[model samples]
Target: MKYNRLLCAGIAVSLLWVSPCPILSNEQNTSYASPAPAKGRAYYEERGDIVWEVPTHRKLIALTFDDGPDVSNTPAILDLLRKYDAKATFFVVGSRVEKLPHLVKREREEGHEIGNHTFLHSSFQHISRNKALSELDQGQASIVQATGAGTHLFRPPGGSYNDSLVKLAKEKGLKIILWSWHQDTLDWRKPGVHRIANKVLRNARNGDIVLMHDFVHHSTQTVEALKIILPELKKRGYSFVTVSELLSNREKPDGLIEVNK
Candidate 1:
């Protein structure tokens, strides 16, 4: 398997394009932290290690949708993803996942990633310590029970996170996944399809994590934007991947990280 490389890295990049709807890149992917990786809890105590982007030179991006597994919209979004042969990460709410276990399982079967978005979609950064931890615990349980896998990726609700939330997230063994401002589609606001598509492609770059919501009010606009966005990004030389695939610099697993199912 070929990996992606960063701009400053000395590794020779091998470009292999997988033909289909969206193209897949075989270039090596690596991260060069601005402040650098460190040891001890004090190290991850900062926000950088929480991982907002992959920091690679290869033209690869991860599409992450939050608060989903909805009966109506999730299937539509999944259809769009299938149409483009693209993979994405879904940060799902626990209760929603419980109510839509089949949808959650479908996401796993279809090769999309599932992440913990909290049981109640509460503000982990602002909630009380126990409450915040409880949210993560419950969310993890629901996901594992529903999909028979554990997610190491988590995204705070509404993107309202802080260093404290980082600590709690690490306690749960989850790596925080945030969105870059440049790639935020803002489809949650029901932005017009054209506007959402334009925003994502405007300043898109390598190692970007474009944020969209599958069930934010509804997913019609998001699904429509994807019809345009996926192929357009592919045309502009971008490959879609899951968050873990982007971070780990490898292909996504055949299924999720299954636990004792």
Candidate 2:
């Protein structure tokens, strides 16, 4: 994903100074007041860059999954989540949602939140404006048709996005969502389950949006990790919530979004 280099660097540096809860001074407060464009220009301009990721100080975490409605795998993940009595955000591809509208409905019916991952899971940056809009439109329509759900949130495939794209989405009344923490499971690479679990446990924190997968085989590892990670977080007094619930208070147009899970 193409990311804004300056934005990426800024986040890394910012993360270094930000701990659990260091109340910002009055001057520091003014600087971070505005909500950023969730996905930056680079996300839509470059096909391989992730535009933006959220950073916060609250003790809440957003768990998200992407690229699926893969019948076999997605249901299992949902089942596991149900067992834990947890809810999360699923960024569903437009085409995939069409193929498995029932699954999409289940996601919403089950009390899980759904967001647009675009139609066909393609790069919003590389495609033409017309095609990009079509992808977004199709996905949005499919999700609504399938679940009677209104999704104003979008997560670009591969997290690639650009300025024009953000504007387009916003004009359509959608908010771009991205993640702050990555478990780095690379589940598609078939990493071990235990290892993936450990990575999340070690890196997760309050207000973290953890990225994991549902389509890949090794994603089972992510499920396994969640088993341990969720309990541990609970022990530490951290609560799990959908990306929107954690990022935004009762008021505010911005919220944390889970992506590329």
Candidate 3:
């Protein structure tokens, strides 16, 4: 499962149109505060009914797409998933779902799971408790309107969460779903397609919840990367499932809590 770093570097050099820096990265000379230490799966689980990756031995991976139901990308992504018989969970924006309800409907109709990504995709870390509740409620309402069903999963915008936000999510009967740390493709940054494909292929493992995006502000890197990722992973005997399906295989805890890498 090792990636060829030389090949990836060469591809990046050749793809001159691709940005040399990530879009989300701070500009040069900008002084930003250092980030906090990364939290493990246990940190989230202990805080609330949150899950990053399930502990399991089966070759099951949950592919989750956030910030979507995009007109240009989502349908194509769905087609590719269908081609490989892979099911994914899409955490769609409530506003987008209201406008493009058909796309959300297509996702559910194709056996993919849909989760709320909030009405305005607001970060709960900065908003008030009442605002957070409104985001959750409105987001759920949009999903139910589109698919005629409510979702039990929610992923805060940018993975921001705190004690109050988690409690609010719990009160709404939503489990906060995050991705396995290593499986984030960063496709939203519009990195070269090979890089995105390699990130997932190289780090993929059992019980992984892979984070990808179906909407990326006029970029199709995720869709293009999937063109390579899906078949290659299928060859490796990995079975793609919805987040709910993967969660069903979670191992029961027996006193000691083992940290997931």
Candidate 4:
């Protein structure tokens, strides 16, 4: 039951791009499922192609935290972020934001950027088109209601997306934000802090988007790693930026760019 709850919440995280119509009542169609491994699928068939994780010559990196406005760990994470004088992105769940409006406000007041991670965080592929758009709209509404700010960026839950999903989000004036590299702190599994920290420290590079969660036990581990990683990267001449900031700085001609997705 505990695992099921987590899976449901995680799957519901893909609220962006849901259609506006009432959700259909059907367990097999509406219910969330465990993420299936798509490794053997073709690149286009796999969701990874929609994500970005590439190296560059610049001295910059973006740290993105997902699944919050958390009751646990968010305050501490914000405190640590403040202490380090570092700015990071938080891709918050819309429902969570409604519950923790103050946290969302605090995040915005502190000048950190927020991205929509959907209301329920449901699986994008599982939900209908109307549900997907509805989720994103609800998420945006919640963020504005909480923080009096608007977000132009979004990160699909489970790092998943499709052509229709992208089109829907873009039509709503949102950019589908996916990471290039992942930290996979697997904090959900209660991994050790040291292991999580080491993986991010060892793997992150310029233009890479490192994924971490701010809502669970392993979050502290990622935070701990950040304390070391942030300074070390600084020493190595790396500058940290929000995902939008990083994306905005990428050189482009005619202001036209491809969706990294």
All-Cα superposition RMSD per candidate? 18.5, 15.2, 15.4, 13.1
Model 1, C-alpha of 29: deviation from truth (Å): 42
* Tens digit of per-residue lDDT, candidate 1, span 8-31: 243433234345674323212211
Best by lDDT: 3
TM-score against truth, every candidate: 0.76, 0.71, 0.81, 0.74
Question: What is candidate 3's TM-score against the reference?
Answer: 0.81
Taken over the whole model, the C-alpha lDDT of each candidate is 0.77, 0.70, 0.85, 0.73
Worst 10 residues of 4 by lDDT: 31-40
Candidate 2 structure quality by residue, lDDT tens digits, 1-261: 357887899899988894677654443232211134455445542432232333456676778888887878888888877876778899898888888999989988888899998888776544566677788899899898889867977887665555566667777777777675355556656678767777677877666677777777434666666677777777777766786776462212364343432
Give per-residue lDDT, candidate 3, residue 140: 96
Which lDDT tens digits does candidate 3 get at residues 1-261? Answer: 136888888789888776567453433322211123145547767654678888787899999999998999999999999999999999999999999999999999999999999999886654555677788899999999999999999998888665556667778889989889999999999989999999999999999999999989979899999999999999999999999888777665653334432
Q: What TM-score number comes out for model 4? A: 0.74
Q: What TM-score quantifies how close candidate 2 is to the native fold?
A: 0.71
The digit string of per-residue lDDT tens for model 4 on 156-175 reads 88877655566677688887
Name model 1 segments beyond 4 Å from true.
Answer: 1-48, 250-261
Off by over 4 Å in 4: 1-51, 54-56, 217-219, 252-261
Residue 120, candidate 3: C-alpha displacement in angstroms: 0.5
Candidate 4: residue 56 Cα off by (Å):
4.1
